[model samples]
Target: MKQKSIYLIRHGETDYNRQGIVQGSGVDSDLNAMGQAQAQAFYQAYQHIPFAKVYTSKLRRTMQSVQFFIDAGIAHESYEGLNEISWGVREGKMPNSFDNEYYRTLIENWAAGHTDYPTDQGESPEQVANRQKPVIDLILSRPDENPILVCMHGRAIRILLSWLMNEKLATMDLYEHSNLCLYKLIYSYETKEFTIEVSNDSTHLLALVMHQ
Candidate 1:
């Protein structure tokens, strides 16, 4: 089996993120000032990794979070598959409003093992895993030794992490996920399996240790 590394990161904070608004795949926003700083700090710390390619969700935030790499001429691609879990009508709404009561309930249900629950027009967690898993399989099928970087959203990263680690998709968000936090997975070709090397890591932020 070929040994490979995959680095995953959530997009930087957007204005909506700071406002505690919902930003599913439908809401595309750029990184705020603090988000930009976090991105820079992440790059300064891990720029030495020699990534083979960079992949990001189609949303602006994911791309913005890793803009430094793109600016430095790293090979990159945007995939719709990496987009966040769709929240239906709550895409641009606040988290706790009456309209999003169902949304909140759905997520709580998801956290509590009801993976099939979703609000009006929203996507089930299963749908997200179906979309993200294929991309992961394709990347791991390659016989190269180069590492890869994937910049995506919080919920999507959680789903991807669960899928990659062969864990129950129902508990994808059991771990903490901060904006621009990193997760690392190592793939063993001989065993044709992936292992978690790190999860929800923000050590690169140094002084921003308290940052969410």
Candidate 2:
């Protein structure tokens, strides 16, 4: 059975990440200094792989994380389906008592097995999984994008992978994740199924630099 593969990376860290702010799909912040270093490390580590295509969410962070590839003349595309789950009214606020309680509650709820509970003005895990469906289908349809390089956000990527793994959405975050970490999922055309080739791997950036 022929299998299709994609190389996925969670976008590098942002200032929001460092300061504990909520930077979801609604927040279009770019990569911070640490984030840039992480991206460069990834590029240097895997520059040998000829990515068939690069796909990212419609956010600056995702795109910026892959700017090296784009500069290398690698073809790329964007899909809103890959964006992070919107954090609603908490978009720019820090996840602290001083700023907002909603963000913490949201995270706690998600981790406590309440995956479908939506943000007051944002989205739920179920909603994220639903929208990310098309992105998965599109990648499967285009095998030419084999070794498709995907750059996206944290929470949303978990939902995407959970959908691919046929796991319950409540257990989605069971898959470990980190900034600039890489994961791979392969789909077999013959069987019409998917398999995770790798998950939450960031050894390539190890000891490269320290980050918060």
Candidate 3:
């Protein structure tokens, strides 16, 4: 058993994000101009880390977020397990008052321990975690691929971290995230546990913030 370092990040913003539209697994969108700039910023900051492998959701946005790494010849892989949760009826819809209230109630339900409750035809937290199990297992088994970079979506990241940290799905909101935010974790094979070294870090985007 060997220790491993995981550099997990949410994909950069898309037009859906900028426009406040719901983009779940059902929608496959490309990164907007701002997203491309964000990807460049991330690449500039982490280009020297010597990542062993890069993993992304099957969605193009996730891959695009880490394109620089893939272009640099780093081995890359995509998995459905890393895809964003399907928003079902809400997918690609701009929020209206009704949708806003629906989400508020959904979050409240989730907070009330009904974590398995799904959106209208969408995935539940438990369902997402189940699909992610195999991916996490595979990553843990491959010790040679240390210091891997994983680009995934927002809610999926929260769910994955909850599972890795032994936290209940209802508490996943504690793991807040933003586009291109990094969450660095260390896995100890000996202890069979994950330590969150960095949580929701966006320091690399400071220059972008300053420029804006």
Question: Which one is best on TM-score?
Answer: 3
Pairing residues by index, what is the TM-score of model 3? 0.98
Off by over 4 Å in 2: 98-108, 111-114, 210-212
Task: Put the candidates in lDDT order, highest first.
Answer: 3, 2, 1
TM-score, per-candidate, Cα-based: 0.92, 0.92, 0.98
lDDT of 3 by residue, 118-189 (tens): 989999988999999999999988998989999999999988998899989999899999999999999998
Taking the tens digit of each residue's C-alpha lDDT, what string does model 2 give over 13-57? 899998888788888998998899999989999889989899999
Off by over 4 Å in 1: 97-101, 209-212
Candidate 1: TM-score?
0.92
lDDT of 1 at 108: 80
Candidate 3: C-alpha lDDT: 0.95
Q: Report the Cα lDDT for candidate 1.
A: 0.83
Global lDDT scores for all candidate models: 0.83, 0.86, 0.95
User: Which 10 consecutive positions of candidate 3 have the poorest summed lDDT?
Assistant: 203-212
